[model samples]
Target: MSTQKPIRKAVFPVAGLGTRFLPATKAIPKELLPIVDRPLIQYAVDEAREAGIEQMIFVTGRGKTAIVEHFDIAYELETTMEERGKDLAVLDPTRATPGDIITVRQQVPLGLGHAIWCARAIVGDEPFAIMLPDELMVGEPGCMKQMVDAYEAVGGNLISVLEVPHDEVSSYGVIDPGEADGALTEVRGLVEKPPADEAPSNKIISGRYILQPEVMRTLETQGKGAGGEIQLTDAMARMIGTQPFHAVTFAGNRYDCGSKTGFVEATLALALERADMGSEIREIAQRLLRD
Candidate 1:
């Protein structure tokens, strides 16, 4: 969509300690947990690939090696499939082609900003995309693609904006809209995790982003903001007048796959959408809901 400054690289911040989903997450990285048939991080990677992202930069902590492996071809399985002449379609979507991925370690459990900063060498002076795997956005044209279209129109920094209920404002980075032209909004400012009643607006920032390289410099100085951790919003807020920042309200259904309820919803929704799983999923969902 953005022919001018086509986004080539994407940064995935997968270093957070998923303390919220403990025990199950004790041995496994939260990003590796399956949402329907594919892992949560796979959904993010697929979204990036669809949007023409060539270099996949993942900022992972310890025990996230599985994520790197997920994007690699299972040599043994692939050889078997080729020999048996199996419909390659059965292969997992998570397996990306060779040389498509690069990983950086976020040794400290700092925060999202720090995690992203870890990939500075890889991103190096270019407009890049950021996709949080926890936010599984489902739609016709994927969320990042929609943002790329909007970015082409207003080239600065673009972030996905969705209207959440007033009470839910505290759970997200809220935006103050300057001007609204359909789905695109001129972002006046952003406040991270403000109290529900103190929030400026109901519109919240989703995980999808198309950010300028300059913001990384701002992040370098941003020691902490809301939670005593390097805050990406803090840096983005500084780029207000300097860079043209806007919020794109894309048409999509987003699920918070980090939470149990949201994960279950995504599982059911994705399963029901699949041709093979639709009938059984519908029957099970209907029976469960009826009871």
Candidate 2:
């Protein structure tokens, strides 16, 4: 039985008007926020590339033109660095060539489902990966790659799931398991941001998804489930009986960069991992705590 289905395209929804970050987000896209030296979205794209994704489709919104430009080649900057014999460390990550990237504008202020729907004409019909830039997963093999391997073994719709606190289950899409292996669970049902007491299980959706093309059709008419938006969970829930849906409970640390605290924590955590800046970052945090 061949499980692999030539999953090449990936859809990244970056159109969210990050109101939570406020004034800072006014000028900058939340996806562009720095995680160490690399912007958050770059990590998402890098993860997709590592997982054998061929085309990068960024679903962007107004005021997100810069997002398109960031992935483009900066000729002047590259030329200057080449002439000066300076190591273009910055250009290393920015080296994703022109054709590999594509952008579609989500003119309306719709939810994640709508943002994905915008890429339908381009995506056509294919099993694609969806990675939210805000969810930064730090792991040995990268989160998406782990999911891709699992998808090969399991051969169905795969979602990256992790156990969060029971109290915090309401903050995420909860998954109910029918059968469980070491790191994979046969998904019984999906609860979108249920109340703490009503949540089916502690396993919550973390942002990495290896979804089937049929999901796009569901999203097209998903209407609105949670928060009055066409929830992706609502669509996924519908596919339970027809297709094999499983949650891959892989081990990794995920940070919610959408929130201020999460963003700051990610910055400090990554900074502490760097050889040049770790000492300075640790000392500053220690001094701040001491004072």
Q: lDDT per residue, candidate 2, 97-188, as tens digits?
A: 76788999988876788888888888887788999999999887899989988888877799999998899998788898889988999999
Best by TM-score: 2
- lDDT, candidate 1, residue 136? 95
TM-score of each: 0.94, 0.96
What is every candidate's alpha-carbon RMSD to the true fold?
1.8, 1.4
Model 2 stretches astray by more than 4 angstroms: 1-3
Report the number of the highest-lDDT candidate. 1
**Local distance difference test, each candidate:** 0.88, 0.87
- For candidate 2, the per-residue lDDT at 42 reads 90
Worst 10 residues of 2 by lDDT: 90-99
Model 2 gets an lDDT of 0.87
Candidate 2 positional error at 214, Å = 0.6
User: Candidate 1 on 3-96: residue-level lDDT in tens?
Assistant: 5577999999988778888988888899989987788988898888888888899898888888888777788988888899887775567667
